[model samples]
Target: MEWAPVCAEGETYANKCMADAAGAQIEYEGECENYFTKEQAQIAAKKWLEEESPTFKFDGIPGSIKYIGYESYTCFGCFGFTFTFNSSHAGYGNRSGQMLAQAIANHTILVQTRGKNVSYALTDGAFDELRQIFICPAISALIPVCGTDNITYPHPCPAMQAGVKIAYEGECQ
Candidate 1:
């Protein structure tokens, strides 16, 4: 997510936090004309992870870890990167079954990057904000809605929890 300030003289920042910190009035609904795409962001994140934290493991076996997904947010004035990983299909003893679910639902790998520098936060999640989705109540009625992220959520809570705006009422086409 990139931000361009409301004023013509204002500069564009990588994310919202930078814009806010710089006292730039941002047009939140729109994105800057030029910014790194999701692919670039993911690549940078993966490269940083593999190179800087080669010893990191999700569930005892580093080979079983997978890059599930990622989301970008702002921090101060520098480029901020947060990468979250999860256990793979091959599960081991304690980190398996329901226990695995609970563990993943609660923790994540947070990696931050700035220029050639990288650091680890040691705790976080890809959809930590939407963690409730994992325990959503069994619905007797289904009220699906299409989210601005172009994904269909069973109910508004899932999308809302994930910080996704409702685009329309129904599944995405």
Candidate 2:
């Protein structure tokens, strides 16, 4: 007789070892719910970010929000979600977590307002010229820096050369 491992959810595994590795209870065979889809998780992540923003606090500032990207994972008896985001203003970098939606939301709001709080107005034509000059090199170097104007630069040098003071050392987004 050929023996196969049956998990608690009645999912057949290649063998007992495989089932155990998956964290499936061998004795309680039944049905398992479907795993969360990427799109669904993304939506949930966005909603979580929005809902959790009210309580998010950073650097003694309130109502700040950060940008976030979501990814989904499947574990033995549960589904897992993770967020990728930047938190440099309060002083940090690309970070990930299963429960970082609030942090990301706060940081994003901070970055968005980083430029607005300051008063530095530039003409559309001048801004366009500066963008043309520095955007390409910054893109090639892969250095994302934010300017005092709240505009994100491809690199710090570009922002400096353009006479735009560097506000932060990472992408605003």
Please give the lDDT score at residue 89 for candidate 1: 28
Badly placed stretches (over 4 Å) of model 1 are: 1-36, 57-62, 75-107, 115-119, 123-173
Residue ranges of candidate 2 with Cα displaced over 4 Å: 1-28, 53-68, 71-173
Whole-model alpha-carbon lDDT for candidate 2: 0.40
Candidate 1 C-alpha RMSD relative to the actual structure: 15.0
- Screening candidate 1 with a backbone cut-off below 3 angstroms (N, C-alpha, C), the clashing residue pairs are none
lDDT for position 21 in model 2: 78
Model 2: per-residue Cα lDDT at residue 34: 38
Model 1, range 1-173, lDDT digits (tens) per residue?
Answer: 54443321124566667766787767443444333445554566566555444223334334434566554555322244554444442322132223333243323455544323443333333222212222244567779999999999999667756656678999999
> Mind giving the per-residue lDDT tens digits that candidate 2 earns over 1-173?
33564444436665666677788666433333332344544444444434432222122133333334332223332322232333323322222331233432222221111111211111111221112232223245667898988999887767755666677889875
lDDT over C-alpha atoms for residue 118 of model 1: 44
| lDDT scores of the candidates, listed in order | 0.49, 0.40
